[model samples]
Structures are given as structure tokens and as C-alpha cells.
Target: MSYRIRPAEQGDNEAILTLLQGTPQQGAVTLNFERQPDYFRGARVACEQPDVWVAEARDAPGKVGAVYNVGWRHVWVNGEVRPIRYAHDLRIAPECRNGMILHRLFRHLRKQLAEGEWMQTTVLQDNQASLATVASGRAGLPTYYPAGTIETSMLYTRQRMPRLPADIAIRQSGSADLPDIAALLKAQGQHKQFFPYWDVNRVHGDEYCYGLNASSFLLLRIGGELKGVLGFWDQKPIKQTRVLGYTRGMGMMRHLYNTHSVLRGGMRLPAPGGVLSYLSLHSVIVSNDDPELLRLLLDYAVAFFHGRYDALICGFFQQDRLAKVAERYRRRLLLSEHFLVSYDGDPRGTLDMNRPWYVEVARL
Candidate 1:
């Protein structure tokens, strides 16, 4: 099967979008074929930055058989910030599922990659096709090391006006909180690739982590000492296009589950993937050995966005101690699993499975 592999062009948008709505094996959504917003959107234009590749059928002229994209981010690893690339939207038309078309498509993209740069990608833990494809050595894809799995949890919070003790302080943040917030994020984000550094002025400026204003951020302290921070990220444009079909089974069981939440005065949870609008728990940084602070901080987050969002989405590495603690609070666990694949050996020599990671929805 002869095909043409080249950088994606503006004219390929429609074809790419159509291809994205593929069979369960390759579609972005697990169980449905709903159209997602141009994941690349404005960034696909040449001047804006073209990050996609298209595999066109040589016999059929302009027909696109497959499409793939690369997402890049600057991350702190080991001890310094470095650029890392991640793979996304790797899809092949249903008719081309046989043969070596998938490998051929990935091969083209691999050859064009820069030398010495580490590439990263995440996949749903249950997506057998993607998991097998990445693990298959004969697939003509780059070699990837399975660092570890990360999970996203849908945490719920409610509105509560209570008297606070003199030692406990939870409030909206101000400019004064930036430095500690930045340091805390870095402290928690160490050892993970693509963990963005916080700027004193633009605290969460990285593309995958974008919390800049104080109003969208919350801080917690004890006796004038900063203990924890959380930020609400409004994924506005992408929200409308998210497909809840990814977790249909959980969506069905949501009513029974939310009954207890409503009884407890909490908002009903969005059926998994049912969130069309949400607030991501960004900059989830907390002090060492402070599970109580974590609970207090999360309580504030839940109360802060109550009634304003369909759901509250939070991501954390599997080993995070807070995972165990949070599970005890509300076991809305098993949201989704993600694997961070690092192609080629890590340059920083800091790629250990037990290290701290900044797991969030944007990276997924």
C-alpha cells in the first residue's frame, strides 16, 4: 500500500476530524465517535505552528488514511526545565485497519522527529489497541518506556459557611501567595516530565497547566505558614466537545451513587465523562506529611466551585499518599487511568517509577 506522509495542512482539517471519529480501537473517545474540538484548533495553521501529520493514499490522491499530532511542553525533570514531546490523536481509517497502515503512519512521524529529544504519550489503561500498539516492537513506532500509570479522580465538594478556628485560615489568594505557590508546585512536581515551572508573576503559565489569576486560585495556611494550594482551571472551549461516552457504564450508575452525595448535601457527580463543563484541580501542591492540610484544602475547593460546574476533575500520580486519604473521604475512584510513555532513554537519569509527578487532565 503506497501512501504519502507529510506535515498536516489546513486543507486536511476536515479529513483529520473525520478520521478522529474512528472505530473504538483508535478513536479519542473510548466507546463513542463524537467529534472533539479541533484538538489542535488555531495551532494547526502554518504561522501559528503546525503540529500534525497526515497519511494520504497515493492511489486516491487527496484522501487522508491516517492523522497524528505532536503536543510539546517545557517541563522540570531531575533539576532543570527541558522540552518534551507527546503523541496525540493517532488514528487510522476503519478500512485501513488491516495491513501495516498504522505502523507505516507512525514510522513517518518517527523519522521526522528531532534527535535526542524524549517523546511522551498517554493512553487509557483499558484501551487494549493503543496499549498493544505502543508495546508492539514490529509496529515501526519509537521505543517507549512505560514510566507508570496515573489516575484522574472526580472529587465532589459542597458549599458550607462555618466558623473557623483562629489557627485555620482558608481564603482566596492574593499576589503575596505567588512565591510559596510556585515553590510548592515545583516541590510536588519534581521527577515528572513536562511539569511546568511556575513564574512569580504568571504562576501557572505552562500550556498544560494554566492558572494565572488569584481569583481562580485558593490557598490554605496554619498560623501564617502556607500549607497547601489548589487552582480551578476552566476548560471552556474544549468542554462543549468532550464525549462522556468514554465511561458509559459509570454514567449509568451515577444516579445511585449521587443519591448518597445529595443526601449528604453535596452536588450530584457528573456521570464519568458526562462533564461538558468543569474545573480541573490544577497546581495541587501540598506540604510534606500534611494529610490534614490536604483534606482541608480539598474541602475548600469543593465548596469554592459548588453549583458552578458539572464536575470537579482532579488528577494525581498513583503513589500520591493523598490518593489513599482522599479515597477514604469519597471513593469516586476509578475515573480513568493514564500511562506516561517515554520514547528513548530519559536524558535526566531521573526517570524512576517512584518519583513525584504532576498528573492533571490537560496532560491526558
Candidate 2:
């Protein structure tokens, strides 16, 4: 009945995935073990190689009881770039939670971190058990501090909703367009606090392209000049759950506001164990400071995927350059949120909503 916690290695992928393929809904999330084609390529090649921890048992040897990824990032926070490590995909077998295994696994993880290195993680605000764990952080252990909430605006463009600006054209992007796409993302990255500092050279290489269900890009042009760019990602098959009661912790009014947004659209809101056939609308960047450019892109995306997907997901940290435009599509947007937390609190109070923050789609 003994278990050992150790760093996960290459051969452990299947075991790790088995743990992720939930026995049933463990909490609000149901992570997909079925990853998309080459989806992890960019994440695997991150500057700080991803590290994972697995719980191996002695009795039923080769059995994985739990797993998590201590993924790394280069982020801009408070006008300074710092290394940030994210604790992602934390999964523990339902049978294992009551034991002291959770504590021991985390304690082992603590030993791996170097001095002054902060590890960041996120949790659903309503996932009380995980939040309580973060709140009770042991002495000398890295405790995740809830900095602020990042809302993921999921829009279900089931039928066509017109808003496409006149005279703008959308075209498919190719390998020859990498430089243009990279440059656009970089320009937009500067506006968000937690946006990753992409190693563009590597990002432009072969690895990053084949990392999604579709490595597709769209260029929006006005009179032969590029005004905006958008990426189409089929985040489907690699799914996530919209566990219903996860919203129980929100204030009545906020919940009502979100519910109203959903009900008004008449689209079936995702349920706890459902495979969110989500299409990610990512790599959103624009020039000319025009909110209308975002409009054009959204319009084109709706037209492009009219019957191909159920919903489109897009998000930005509050006060991001796109936030203003996002508001313009208020009627079409529904609510979901992710947290941007740090192990070390922002002593400078800089990672506020007023300041920009970014969570790259690839990392999430």
C-alpha cells in the first residue's frame, strides 16, 4: 500500500494520461487525456522544460495515483519580466485524497524548487478544497497567492451574427507568413502583464506550427494593408468541463449576470462531464488601434466555422488592449474565469486588473 512520488519521465505518459482520464468528475474539471495532434509540441519545447510528478504505488505497482505539471513561463509582470512556473494538471485519484499522499507529494515538490523561485498556479475560485490548500501553505512552502481573476469569454456563434466591417478581407496564412504573425503577437504581447515573452525564433520553427488540431491563421486586411490577425485552433478532443455548480461560490448578482448572458443566447451551456467541442480563437493581435479590427476577425471566424464547431473561446486579462473591443460584443459573450496567481504576492501591487495581463492559449 506504499507509494513513491517522483519526477515523471518519457515512458510515464500513458500512466499519466490514465490518471487524467477521470474515473468520473473529480471536481469541476474533466481534463482530456486525448490530446490533439502535436498539441504539446510548443509546451514541450518551452525554455524551461516541463517537469511532472507522478505518484507510483507499490501494491498495484505501475499504478499512478496522482500527477501534476510544474510548467515554466517567461512572463511580464509589473513592467518587469520574470520566470514563472505554473502548477498545471493536478490530478489525484478519488481513492487517494483521504490519505496523507497529497501532502507528501506537494512536500516533495517543494524540495525541487530553488531559492527565490516562485511557482504560479490557478484554480477555480469555487474549488474550495484546492483553494484551502493554497491558503494553508506550510511554512517555507510556496503558497499560491490569488492575484486576480481572468475572465474567459466563450462566445457561441452557432448561427451567423453579422458585424463584419465593410471592405475587409480575410485570407489563410502560410509558412511564409510566420514573421508577420510572430511580429503581430509580439506587438500585442506588450499590452498584457503575464503574456509570455515568446522565443520567436523557436516559435517560428516547425515545432510550434503543428501544435493544434489546426495550425491555422487568418489575416485581416483593409485595402491591401494588414489590420489584424487571428488563429483558428480546434481545441476539441482535448477537452475541458464547464462543471455547473463550480459557480456556486460567486455572488448571487454576478451569477445572475452570467446566467442571464447564457440564457439569452439559448445555446446549451456546457455541463460537468461534457466534452466541450471548443474551437479556440487565439493569437489575437491588431494594428491601427481599431476595435473594429477585432470585430472583423470575430465576424470572419463566425462565418468560417458556422457549422464546423459549437463554440468559440477567447479571453484576455482585464484592461488588455482587446478588452474594450470584447465589451462591444457583450451580447455574444458568456462568462467563465481563470485565475492568474503567484506564489509570491505582488508586493508592488502591480499585477492589478487595471494593468494588462496575458495567458497564452498554448499554456492554458
Candidate 3:
């Protein structure tokens, strides 16, 4: 049956939710709504937004089959703010898995993205169907490899912190440390196609950076020279009873980012006097190119978080040698084979998934 593609409406939320729930092969069925209502709400909000799109079979009215949640962002690349599009979520119901359905939907999506000047969507590594769909098209090409799946790794420890064979020490970052952080970030910017919204400067200036009653950043220093850094935030899970309070009037899109930001921040937002564990392994780097130094820095970061929090989660790219280094620390693989696509300048030069670098989607 022929399908009609149109923008989703508020009334279609139930159908969309049903489709999402019905597609079990996509996994994440046990996703905690209490902890992350924003994900579901954001899907509805995307449909309501003019930029979002939905596909429904013309012969089956009211049966929403697929969804493509897209958004725009300005990336600082090559010293300029470049407009890019993020394809956040794309789902197709099981009943609509016919190849023709996907073909038509993708064709429509490509046309929309091309006209809108969107660069690309960062596909999750495990979503093989989506990856194949994008790669099947002539217009589609592998762009960027963001990170490996979210996995449980060895708890952070002080001893694990990387210290150069010389005199490096792991210490709390200070306001004065922003310049060195900026310099490290600038070095990363040179090779990356798309720039993340939260950079070193923003992190240093944001509320999360100031650490109001909570630690947010850690720096590895050698003889007063900054060599590596990490960031974290305090976060806690919302009880089922508190779901209403958490969901109360939160805008869909904003809530989406909020939930993800909280999760990615790696620390749970603290509940009232409840001494919930507080910490997140935001980012890590070691200036020493030696693999041994990198391993030391990673071990130390994990040890730091493990000591501070009940759980330590990190996002490392598949190509990053750190992924292998992290494995030595009892890291349990959570999400593996995630894909990131970027639309930088020229598509050819902008997308390079084979490069060895971890893309940080949300900073903890």
C-alpha cells in the first residue's frame, strides 16, 4: 500500500507511542519512563514541531508507521559557526517494515534534509536497520564515529588516574584552568567535522561547572601544567510517584535534552537530604601520546569516579584506542556499534567515520 508522509500532530501521540512500543526489535522496551519521560515526550514534541515528520500508510488512516525527529544546531568548525541538522530519533513500526515503506520514507527524509541544509544524523551504533537504510542511499556516506556503546566500566579510583612517569598529579580544576581546557578542546576541533554545542568554554561557565555543593571537574596536572580533564554532575532517579512532578508541563524538546543531559552527565541529580552517590566521568584526555600514558589517565579517571559514585559510565568511540584500554577495567558493554553522521562543509571532506576520536554527545 502507498504511504503518505506528513508532519505529525498532537493527536498522533498515542499511535506513535503504540508503534514505538510495538517495535520490540528496536530494544529499549524497559526504558525507565520515571527516569526519562522526556524521550517519549520529545517524540511527540518533534511531531508537533514543523520540522519533524511522520509517515502513515494512505490505506490505513490513523496508523502512524514511522517517525524522524530532526533538529538544527550551530557548530563551530574551522573557526566558524556552521548550521547542521541532527537526526535524533527515527523509528518504523514492525508492521511497516516492508522494504518499500523504508525506501519511500528515506527518500522523503533525504529530500527534506537536502532542502533544509541539514548535514546528517548521528545514528546509534547498534541500530543496524537505520545504518543500512542510510548507507543504502547514494547520498548517504559514513561521516563520523562518535563513541562506543555506553558500558559499565571499572569504578574510578585515585590510583587509576594517569600520572606522567614524571610529576603529574590529579587535582580539582579551578576557574583559572579554563584556558588550558580551551586549548585542548581547540586541538580536538581541528580534526572533527561537526562541533558539539557544549564546548570547554561553555562547560567552564555553566551552572554545572561552578559545582554548587557538588564536584564537577577534575584535572590531571604535571608540575603545574594541565594535561587532562573530566567533568561530572549530581543526578538522581525520579521515583515513580514523583514522575508527575517531573513530567509536569516540561516542554517536549527541552525535556528531551534535559533527560539526556542528566543521563550523559553521568551523575544523578541529588534528591533532598538523601546521600545518593554523586559524580560523572564527563571527559578525559592525556597529552602524552604514549599509549601507556593514555592508559594511566583512563585508569585514574575511572578510579576517581568509582570512588565518588555508585556507578561510572563513559562514552568512547569504537575507533578510539581508549575503548580497548577501558576494557581492562571491568567495563561492561552497554551500547555498542553506535553511528554518528555529520554534515560539515563538503560532504566528502566533512564525514570521516574511520578516524580515531571519541565524540561526546552529552557531557555528564
Candidate 4:
């Protein structure tokens, strides 16, 4: 049962992917968040210089028992843009999930982080096992301070796009729009904690914006002035969410729902083992955080992404007023508990509660 933790190399991709496939997030509809083709592709895009770690069985060489990653990027915190780490993709094989393995992994992780370095992570609210583990106060583990809830919605494009006002315009962005896009994102994003600091000029070459380009962004303009921008990213080429299985009752319920959806124009639930086709809505910024502007952008996005994706996914902290906009759509909601982890001190008290919290769902 001995294990050794080390920085993962290119050779560990298959082992890491295997571990991820075996560990599906349990819920009504179980899902396996998999990195296909290569695991590192998705990891590289998470942030700049992503550091991935893997736990291997000493008795069985090359057999990965667990995997984790720390992705560093500049984000707004307490009204300042600074480097922050996002800890994600912490997966352990079912056979090695005993407390000992997790503690060992954290011990090594703790050694790598600086004294006051704080990181953020999210656990699905329904993941009771994970929630309990984080709250367990295990030795050598960082303290996870409760932040808030992230409400992620899978909005179905079931309705037709609404008409826009004569002065309002929605169009795909061009290369010349980078400056204005950057300006709009920064202006609106500053009001939210953890919103990414965009390098719009380099987005096409940035790993964090992998599979995205200027044309992927949809701009909402009023009287020829940019008011909002939403970027659509399709990560399917690198990362994929496959339907693992549904709970007993959920399986039957999904069958009925799919029947009706197929008859209508709604998005039908994917069959088990099938990959979901969806686009993630990123860089979601609007002037004044206006719900009406967001609605207009989403309406145009629906038309822009129609026939190409089954659904569009986005997330907003429950405290965010704009979260109400998604509630009006035909959608399925998933909630995750956000946390700030630190070994030095708690970050919760220092944060301003008035600001909206934003975590790009695509990166997670």
C-alpha cells in the first residue's frame, strides 16, 4: 500500500486518464469528466504553468493512484489583480481513496506551496464524501474556508431567439476589437472577485483560451458602442464529459424527459457512455452587470450556437444578481460550494462580500 508522490510527466497521461474515468462524480446523472486524446492538453489550458502531481503505487510501478493540479493565473481579488492558484482535478482511484493516501498527497502538496499562498477550489454540493473530507480538518491539510455557492446552469436552446432593438447589435468579434474587448472585460470584471485578467491581444495564442479566437467572441453593442461580450469555447477536442450512468429513478426519469424533448425542440439527455456536446460561455461581462443585456447576449448566442451544441453552460455565484437571468431559461442547475484554502490564515474575512464572485466554469 506504499505510495510515492511526484510531478507527473508526459508518460503519465494514460494513467491519469484511467484514474479520472474510474472516478465519476456521483449524482442523479453520474458523469465522468474525462480528458480524451491527451490529459495534458486540458491541463495546459487550465492556466499558465500548471503544475500537476500524481501518486503512484511503489509496489506497482507506473500505476497511478491519484492525480491533482495547481493552476496559476492572474485574477481580481479584493480589487487587485494578482496571481492566484486554482486547485482542481483532484481524482483518486477507488481502491486508494482511504484517508492515508489523501493525507500523503496533501502533505506533499503543502510542502510545495509558500507560507501565505492561498488557493481556491470547488466541490459539488451534492458530493457529500468530498465535502466531508474537506471539512474533516485532517492533519497536514489546508484549511478550507467557506466562500459561497456557484450555481451552474445547463441552458437548453429550446426557444427561438428574440428580436433585438434597432440600436442594439450582436455580432462576432474581429481582430480589431481586442482592445475594446479587453476594456469591457476589465471594466465589468473588476466588480467580481476571482474574475480572470484577460490578455485579449494574446488570447488566440494563450493556452488558457485554448480553442478560442477573436471570432469566437460575440459582442453586444448599443449604438455601435460595445456594452457586453461573451466568448464561446468548445473544449470537446481536449476534454469531454461522458454520461456514466444515472441513479435508478433518474434513469427512468431521463427516459421520459428525452421522449418529450425529442418530440419537441429541447435538448435530450445523452445516453450512458455518450459524450455531451456543449459550449461553455466564458468571459461573460456586461456593462453595469445588467440582466437585460445578458439576456440579449444569450438570446443571440442561442442563435449563434444553434445546431452546433446541445446546450450552453455558464456559472455565477448565487449572490450575483445576474444569476437570476439564467433562471428564466429552460435549464438544469448544478451547485458547487466554493472555498479558499490556506495553511497560513483564513481569506474569508478579508474579502468584500458586496462584490460578485466569478469562476469560469470551463476551466474547472
Best candidate (score: TM-score): 4
How does candidate 3 score on lDDT?
0.50
Ranking by TM-score: 4, 1, 2, 3
What tens digits encode model 3's per-residue C-alpha lDDT throughout 1-364? 6679998776676776666555433231222112122333443222222255788878888888887666555455545456555565567776678657666765676666553243444554566776666666345443444333433342333323344566867666766777786676456544444434345555433432332222356676768777666555443331111111122233234346436534443323233223334344554555633455556656565556654564455566555565666666543355544444533333444545544444443321
Off by over 4 Å in 3: 1-35, 40-51, 55-65, 73-81, 98-101, 115-166, 174-180, 192-215, 233-283, 288-294, 307-311, 334-346, 349-356, 361-364
Report lDDT (Cα) of residue 319, candidate 4.
Answer: 90
Write candidate 2's Cα lDDT for 186-242 as tens digits: 776666567666554453434433334223778987887766878776644344443
Question: Candidate 2 or 3, higher lDDT?
Answer: 2
Residue 236: error of model 2 in Å? 3.5
Query: Against the true structure, what is each candidate's TM-score?
Result: 0.77, 0.76, 0.58, 0.95
Candidate 4 lDDT, 75-131, residue by residue in tens: 898789988898999998888876489889888988988888899999998889989
User: Candidate order by lDDT, highest to lowest?
Assistant: 4, 1, 2, 3
- Superior candidate under lDDT, 1 versus 4: 4
lDDT of 1 at 348: 38
**How much is 243 displaced in model 1, in angstroms?**
5.1
- RMSD to native, candidate 2: 5.9
What is the C-alpha local distance difference test score of candidate 2? 0.61
